[model samples]
Target: MLTPPEKPVHWNVDDVVVTEPDVIRRAIGAAAIGNITEWYDFGVYAYFEPTIKKVFFSGLGDTVGTVATFGLFAVAFLVRPFGGMFFGPLADRIGRNKVLAITMIMMAGGTFVIGCIPSRASIGIGAPLLLLVARLLQGFSTGGEYGNAMTFIAEYAPDRKRGFLGSWLEFGTFTGYLLGAVLVTVADAVLTEHQLLTWGWRIPFFVALPLGLVGVYLRSKLADTPAYAALEKESEKREKDKAGKDIRTLLRIWPFLLVCMGLVIVWNVTNYMLTSYMPTYVSDTVPNAQGGGVSSTTSQVLQIIVMAVALCTIPFLGRLSDRVGRKPIAWTGVGLLIVLAFPMVLLIQAGSVIGVFLGLLLMGLALICFSSTMPSTLPALFPTEVRGAGLSVSFNVAVSLFAGTTSVAVGGLVGLTGDLNWPAYYLIAAGIVGAVALWFLQEPNGRRMWGSAPAAGSQDEAREVVEHQDREAVPA
Candidate 1:
């Protein structure tokens, strides 16, 4: 266990011991791997939609097959809120390490099932139904995976360097996304079209089984957060009272809740609409030509490359935030996306593969600003007691409201307007929401890790209520 600080002192990176680095490093590594596996499993559905439809929707026309497969992909995003709710307080109540392990196991199991599932030819509708179920499981697992991973890294980090440390979790997500894209590109190059749809796609899904086992093992060795440590201490002190406290206490702080919701919308819109939806947008617009100016495969390969480069740069930028502060880099990231995301789409419309690459590269860089800062900054908004629950509720509500529907909404908008750039404006609106939230958010510089507030449990907020009631009845 982490020993208490010499005083009730706030943390700073410079003060971290040589041993604490190892702890944070280990946590970051696990967090990164979880993201990598999560996206590796999720992104494949986008890149391999052609293959998946071929296997499962064989008799359907090309247009319908593509639609159904994309629909399934969208469904996974829809399940994120439930996953966040299930995993969030589970981690808060039980332990982060235990919940992390359980989540990875669930994901690995889901991926393994996806790998083993039979197609329409063999089992007909059951195949697609089962596939949707597996995707939902994966989606739900991911919901909790990210929030918890970010929370783990943020709580472990020294306050001074929190931005740098927390951003690694997002860096992990992008890295994982790139890894999935690369795997698809490489697997396509290696296998014939006949072989890939038949079996090669399964290879990627199954790969997670072993990787997830390793993730669980690594997480098993991790210690609980200092915030949780203090919560456990407080819980023990107040053993006589065992009352769950979440929504009522959270709603009392409505301003912070609104900010959190807006932030989530921005985060997910840029994430899904830009990263997940881009490949499809390119497939629809850029023709696969004789010279390969802009094909789906080529676009995916470029996306993989862009994501890889962006993921690498994210850590450096995140570390920069540690030096300068989170908001500057973060708002700049959102602002860049707001300014460039639309123009980048128009560049693609101008008809060049180079333009496509250039567009995504700019958007990816801009998206990283928010992605990197969020892991550290969002968690700092609340004290530790209800950190997991508050984040899950706000994040899920925002995502369900904005994110889960973003791809579907964008696709519908495109069909209606005959213009892909319509989605770009949507991205800008999301960024503006984030910028607004940042205006009110506090930077938790030098804040004590524990005992600052009743973030984990209700005792602190609950006691406040009792005091208020007593004062109102007696004297007011």
Candidate 2:
């Protein structure tokens, strides 16, 4: 029941109000914590790919084992769309915080359980089956977790600084990734290969429980976002007048769904490429004239360095987007992917440590462009009433079908043709799709969220916004 002033015809800025800066900080922290938990699981899995293949798919030979490992990685994505379809509308009806808390518990529980599952040697066929169940649970929960988290932060952030603030969500993303990467690297360096395959991998998975608990604690401290609070009030009135289902409303806005999916496709394609596929690609897949690709440890170290760079750069680019607008920054990412995809691939193929680092760094740079901007940009594609559902479904569906499967598709294609450049080809195709989506996107910088009143960090800023609106209302 937080309420702002009534809207004015010529100046919606009448509804502009200052949200306490501390509350906004708490909200961002709460929303971002879930991302950290979720991606931490992914980071652990990606970095442990070779060991996982040995433990779970030992019967399959090297090539098939690699594909099967990546396929399990893709399994979580397969269930994400279902999670979105179920939880998205549920969030719209109940509340974002409630849905988020539920998804978080399930996500953390799934990851923790993966650590406890017995090796294939212990359980035969049942081992991989248990892993599959855990992955499905993780995927289902993630479908709900990410989109709601994005909507939650976007709604809570002030209009003028949304881009800068929203980027913190991904900051948490790389933080989790780095944490997992560092642990795996440490474990690899210290433990023998036999010890790592037997117990070390489980260590990272067990960490998810603690991370998820922290996220839950943070989220429980905050109320649902102000935008969601207001949407609840509006929904009550709509219920009295007999409104349609959220799904039906979402269907009516199909164009936004397509655009959302397209943007997600481009962004996550690059995301999984760098974070998920690159380690395997650099260490196992790429051909080296000297013999094998870079060592497993070298690949992990290179990827960690690249992720560190991206993590540090994301906030600055996000702040920059607030000033320059999201489209230009996203377009720049798309342009880089198209123009540099092959070159980056070639650099990695060179097989030297410096060559691989530069290649990964290039991809990381392209990725942060989308990372910094999309959190703020994608949430703007739908109105508040359906925002959670719209974003969850569209984002998960796109990710499940295209982005999450990057490693699998690229790996399968490479195995089929023995081509080392398929990752580059995949990136180029994604960039082309991104360019098309960008063509249709409306710039969202400095605008209030679609169905929420303007928000400001301070009373003075609110007053300034109203005055600025008044001046604009007086005609050029």
The model with the greatest TM-score is: 2
- Point out the worst 10-residue segment of candidate 2 by lDDT: 1-10
Candidate 1 TM-score versus the reference: 0.85
The 10-residue segment with the lowest total lDDT in model 1: 467-476
Look at candidate 2 and give me any clashing residue pairs: none
Model 2 vs. true fold: TM? 0.94
Q: What shift in Å separates residue 299 of candidate 2 from its native position after superposition?
A: 1.3
Per-residue lDDT over 1-476 for candidate 2, one digit per residue giving the tens place of the 0 to 100 score: 11112253344445775677787899889998999999898899999998999999998998999999999999889999999998887776666787899999999999999999999999999999999999999999999999999988888788889999999999999999999889989999999989988998899999999989988988887865564466457655654553456778788778888888989999999999999998988888774323656888888988998999999999999999999999999999999999999999989999889899989999999999999999999998887778888999999999999999999999999889887889999999999999988888878888777666677888788877777765322111
lDDT of 2: 0.87
TM of each candidate vs. truth: 0.85, 0.94
